[model samples]
Target chain A: MIRHVILRVMAKMLIPLILLFALYVQFHGDYGPGGGFQAGVIFGAGIILFALIFGLEPAKAAFPPRVLEVLVAVGLMIYGGTGIAAIVKGGNFLGYGALSHDPVHGQHLGILLVELGVGITVASVMSTIFFHFGGRGRKDV
Target chain B: MIDLIHIFLFTFLAIIAIVVIRMRDLFAAVMLMGIFSLLSASLFTVMDAVDVAFTEASVGAGISTILMLATLSLTTSKESTLYQRPRPLALVVVVLTGAALVYATFDMPRYGDAAAPINHHVADYYIARTMDDTGVPNMVTAILASYRGYDTFGETTVIFTACVGVMLLLGGARTFYRWRRREDAGDPEPRP
Candidate 1:
């Protein structure tokens, strides 16, 4: 990983922008050709690139495996919670129309939360898989 | 011009596919697969399926390629050379399956046929009512998130299940490494 100054420099410049673009894609999905799935992959790719160029240890330090494991379930819970909230509001399961007084607002909020859940799970799972694969070669487990 | 672009892309795609199949080098094949994914993404973009294209580019080209490369590093990069054994029965089965698939395509509607059963089905209702129902401008998002939310929930669960499966299979790295270390302790150093 060392001795590639150009790659390191370029990576440093691009990683932040890539993560930012992922965020934009996640939030702007309502009006654009992007969403949780795309945004999550992009974000995971960013972190993977960081791990590739700077070494996996630093990446793992930044995003630990334990935290990633927890996040995998947390995202699903958030998604399921949104559905339960709808059920509590007297709407059918996953019916965002009842989340708020205004059905439209409720739909918006539900979509946002659900997408967030997806993004979190996807990003964490991807990074977690990468970490496990990359760490396999190293002596330290 | 667009047709020309499509033709060029498809040509390259075909060439890459052939090369990938014929090449014995696993690394080159993996890289070519990434290119194939990228070309498919471009074709999806040309067809106005930008969301699909995005997913193809990211998951297909990006993550899968990287994962394959990682696996290559852990295993042999070059494919093992096995003696060629031509099985006529296997070839016959594959040829028959391919011919059946091609034959089935004849009864299908032409590309992007507006009157096709799929196009005339609930797609029209979703397109017309997405904005009104979900207040979302992106009809695809509206459909996936609200109209067919239950299905998406199932899909999300599927992804979570995949992660759990992979974790169960690969997450015992530490324990495996520890066991290997214990086994190695009894053996003398055999390699430089």
Candidate 2:
């Protein structure tokens, strides 16, 4: 019980900090050594920690499996949609310069959209994996 | 001074790898593998490949270890000694491969030569045009998300596929929920 309480408190404190760092990494990718992939993993780690401390049931209650499943598909769709949009704009798939009238702005928008997609998919998939493994029942103590 | 530290790290990494391979306990081996990955990430940082280092530290050291532990929980942790005898044919093939690799390295450019073909041609373009192209200060990010975006997309798809496969094989969230519901229904009296 004591261990559970401590874990809960620690999860509450650490998860927020991790999430904040993930956001920092996501937005600051243009200036630093981080981007969508790293940020996504970090964010996912936060959720995984919460799931670990709290029971998988509670974690599932917090973020339902159905929601995560949708998020995963939606993320891919967002990424693919952006690429398709570029193609529709008369450029190669994911050719962001054609996204807008101003090529630089188009590039920025493209990166942001794609990064968001990557972050969402990675975070959802990772958390889902954690739930699967940690929630598994063990016959042996 | 940094170069000395790097050499030390490399030597330490080799020692750790040998230990991990020789270790009889699977759990200990998995933990050692995590440490090995972390050391490798640090080595990548020392080599100035911070992006690769970050990926290594997160995915390699974190998720991979968790996956290995989960697998261990589901299976026997015993190390099978069935194939303990070293095969002469395998040894000969390994030695030949090593010799070929070493010979190929001699023909390649020395460690950090700026005039090397890698630095002069494709790499130079990314380093120079990254800022202009993607408006990102991190050239690696620009390269990964833009110039080599196809590869990144493919990798992401691979990760997604693997996760889907694992979920399908291991009984996903739906099964877990059903199990919980059955447990709840079995209990007639709700106890706080």
Candidate 3:
């Protein structure tokens, strides 16, 4: 692998911008053309870029596999927990009407929370998969 | 016009697909697949599905390409020279499937026909009441996260399952457990 200083400097500059764009996509899905999936993938791509420019060990230090596994599970919980909340509130499974007093507010809150869950899971999983596949057969690993 | 753009995209897509098939080099095929994804993403955007387009472009052009490259690094960069003839049965099967798919397209509703079955279904209700029901301007988000929350949940589960499966197949589970055991013994952790 060619370790070019110019590539290193450019990656350092671009990483933060990429992550910020991902956040925008995450929260802006409600009013525009983005959502958890796109945001998550973008964020994962950013981290992957960081790993590519730097190395696998540094990337793992930044985001550990253990933490990623937990995050993957947590995202699913956030999604499932929302449905359970609705059921507890005397609504049907996955129904958001009972989430708040106003149906609209309930829907908004539910969507936001669920989308967040999806974003976290997707981002973590993609990164984790990268770690696994890339780390394989490496002398460092 | 949108129709013209769609025609251009599909034409490009067909050419890319043919090139990808003809190319024996795995690396070139992968690159062509990315181009194929880009064209399809453009078509999706033209059809007003910006969300899908964004996803297809990002995943197809970015992470997947990198991962495949990483795989090529681990394996041989060049495809092996196998001078095997094409199977007659496989070609016939592919041709029959293509014909069937083309025939099936005739039954599909025309692009964005308001009178289409899908447009007449729950889509109308969602569009009519999205603001009142969800207060979200993005109907796709409102529907995917709230109205069709169950389906999204299922999709999330599928992703989770796939992740877990990969972890198992890639020995992530073994290493993680071993690392934990080592940590219990107060041993220093080495870089993975």
By lDDT, who's the top model here?
1
Pairs that collide, model 3: none
- Highest TM-score: which candidate? 1
Worst 10 residues of 3 chain B by lDDT: B169-178
Question: Clash number for every model?
Answer: 0, 0, 0
Identify the CAPRI category of the predicted complex in candidate 1.
medium
Look at candidate 1 and give me any clashing residue pairs.
none
Ranking by TM-score: 1, 3, 2
Question: Whole-model Cα lDDT per candidate?
Answer: 0.90, 0.81, 0.89
Q: Write the per-residue lDDT of candidate 3 for residues A47-70, one digit (tens) a residue.
A: 899889998889989988889989
CA error at residue B96 for candidate 3, angstroms: 3.7
lDDT of 2: 0.81
Candidate achieving higher lDDT, 1 or 2: 1
Q: Model 2 segments beyond 4 Å from truth? A: A1-9, A138-141, B172-192
Assess the local accuracy of residue A95 in candidate 2 as a C-alpha lDDT between 0 and 100. Answer: 96
- Rank by DockQ, descending? 3, 1, 2
Could you give candidate 2's per-residue lDDT for residues A8-127 as a string of tens digits?
A: 788788888998998998888867898888988988877777766765677788888778877877777778888999999988999989999988778888888887888888888888
Q: What would the per-residue lDDT of candidate 3 be over residues B11-115, giving only the tens digit for each residue?
A: 999899899878878898888888888888888888888988999999998878888988987898677777889899999999999999999999999887888
TM-score of chain A of each: 0.96, 0.89, 0.96
Off by over 4 Å in 1: B176-192
Candidate 1 per-residue lDDT, tens place, A1-141, comes to 656899999999999999999999999999999898889899999989999998888888888889999998998888999999999999988999999999989999999999888888898889888888887767765
